[model samples]
Target: MKNTFNIHEVSNLLDVSIPKLLLWEKKNKLVPTEKDTNGINIYLKNQLVDFPIAKDVFESKWDEEIKIKPLGSYNSIELFAGAGGMALGFEKAGIHHVLLNEIDKFSCSTLRKNRPEWNVIEDDIKNLDFKKYANKVEIVTGGFPCQSFSAAGKKLGFEDTRGTLFFEFARCIKEVQPKIFVGENVKGLFHHDKGRTLQVIKDTIHELGYTLIEPRVLKAMYYKVPQKRERLFLIGIRNDLAEKNNDFKFPAPYKKVLTLTDAFKKGDLFDNDVPESIGDMYPARKKEILDFVPQGGYWKDLPDDLQREFMQRSYFLGGGKTGLARRLSMTAPSLTLVCSPSMKQTERCHPLETRPLTIRESARIQTFPDEWEFVGPKSQAYKQIGNAVPVNLAWSVARSIIDYLNKINVDNRKNTKTILQSESV
Candidate 1:
């Protein structure tokens, strides 16, 4: 890959906006190298690499050899497995799914329709007892929704969260006692309830005999997903092994960012162009109105009167409602996906087309393979895609877990052999 880039090129490469780049430039953090013949400023790769965050910036070229799958026999049990996003990532990482639990019937159908061999358990997580799986799988994972607790007397234990789904997640961890468990949720959970919720989660995991690592918000763009979605992952290593190993590092970020163009076209990310599929559409009036909104423009781009008509009372409100009538740019990563792209507040207008993203397009943004079919109505399909942890992001995290589990297996073998030798003597 070239070691130099122009200002706009750097902005696209780093997922940083032009204004932010200008600010960095003013701060002497992002300096330019020599200029090209057209007088456009060129930035050497070394210049951006000086910043800690952008240090790994490089062009993304997919290599079949760099793909990491499971190193050995590792099994996992998943909860709240909506549409199989996280599970599919682990599947690519080489972890076999012994059983997957999902309460949504449509999501469960989607999972089974795609992977019939999987044991898809469709029931509320609270109804199921995962105790039977104790020692059965090396890992347990879930993307549980966050909920507030009563803040009843400091050290939050498992029972204190009884009424919440997070409690169910903790209960599963306690019962199954896997070597490690992964919990994922939206980034807001880290600060939900003014941080009490996250503190409670930490305390509860400790009470269940697991050591919680500092929660990390992983960016999807850095992990091969062509969207700027961010997910927080909570990793817990069972106390016994945690004390022995003591460290769990996250996977390294990829050097390059993946853009929507990489996602939709026949390129490094996919063998063929994105397949056409059904998606929701705006009303006739909306279609006519959206037709006037230029590519990369949003509701704010509309004429003054139309803006007021489109945004209603929100037109008079303060902060920029940037998502309104927003059109995506192909050169950059897509914005975080909402459940329904055509929703009034979150209009994801296609870069060239005036329509919302199609089902397959959205799935591609979420990093699902083209063959992975989604079931149910278009609305349900959208919800499933929106709710999923981007598969590539999950796969990135899973690689670290696989590395740790492989180490634990090696240690276990040594311990077993030593015990046998001692008994024989």
Candidate 2:
């Protein structure tokens, strides 16, 4: 049937990996109008574009990556710097980290442990003053936890966001007055408070004399992270620079979609297989029930008796509870990592073993390098890794920002030269 291509079939037809296709769908590029009984995406034939362009976009990853380099030295200040995933990635992209701020003690410890040279500020964002960094930092970035602004005010400007963490983020941007600012958060912010929240954000950016590039949700899997995590990015450029030229580009997707095999086994993602580390263990009964579920399978794969025992009353409820008793497939990217792996509604069992993923395994899934260690207890380490942006994904975004900043730097040089020429005349 023309409309019968499942996810696998589409992957083969387009020569793109399953994760890339899913990323396209997330951006509303190639939406599957239907799904098969097995819950696989069923794409229609008419939805596809020509094969040549599709191949170019999906296959030219390495070529695009080789072109990403900073034209000039750029410095950045990072906020909500959880375990330094984004900050590290930016550093790898040739952007220097002038400072990093985080409220979590364990996460701050992790940042300091890995990069002692970094000015790691371990304090609440509200207590800090960003005015000193004005004109000193070119970029400001953060994965600010999403919080709704109060609707009690008439205008949804900077002041309206007060009493929320986002206000602190806004205050930093206003004070620092960086050339560019990047704010990352969950995808749900797009629709939060029936879209009023994002509108307020846009309004606040305008009030701060910056132009907002339309926010986009990037899938980490497409950027070499072996996980299905997604984050929404809001990028703003100072109005003066934007007025002169504003051409910010989002990063290109990597060609290959990695899997748990790439993560846990010796392959492209890692030099050695996942190392031994502390991990959570399933209780006796939970382990017994999950043992029956096969790789890539979930609650439906279990026998009727075990399913009933595991799901309890929810088994009789509607909708497919796929995450229940789920075991990751070695062939596909792992599901989004949460603060804890053994959560009942979102179980993250190992593909082969009957236990939850170890702290190192979780970090690897988030594309955090092995040597980039996490501090504190196992639970805290897991929390830090789970809450981080994928390093490679962050690197991709940073490269794009660098590209734009390079252009700005060239423009600035030209302007100075023109002014000198006129003065001599």
**Model number with the top TM-score:** 1
Query: Which residue pairs overlap in candidate 2's backbone?
Result: none
Model 1 lowest lDDT segment of ten: 57-66
Which stretches in model 2 have alpha-carbon errors above 4 Å?
1-62
lDDT of 2: 0.87
Report the Cα lDDT for residue 338, model 2: 92
List, residue by residue over 221-333, the lDDT tens digit for candidate 2: 77878888889999999999999887788887765567899999999889999999999999999999999999878999999999899999998896888788999978778
The lDDT per prediction is 0.85, 0.87
Which residue pairs collide, candidate 1? 70-93
- Per residue, candidate 1 scores C-alpha lDDT tens digits across 1-425 of 67888876787667678778879878987767777889776898877765555665453323432364555789899999999999999988889999999999999999999999999999989899888888888899999888889853565777778789899988888888899999999999978988888888888898999998888998888887888899899999999999888768787776577788998999868999999999888788888888878866788789988888888888888687888888887878899998988887887889888789999999999999999988999899999998998998888888889878877877888999999999999
Q: Give TM per candidate.
A: 0.93, 0.88
TM for candidate 1 is 0.93
lDDT of 2 at 400: 84
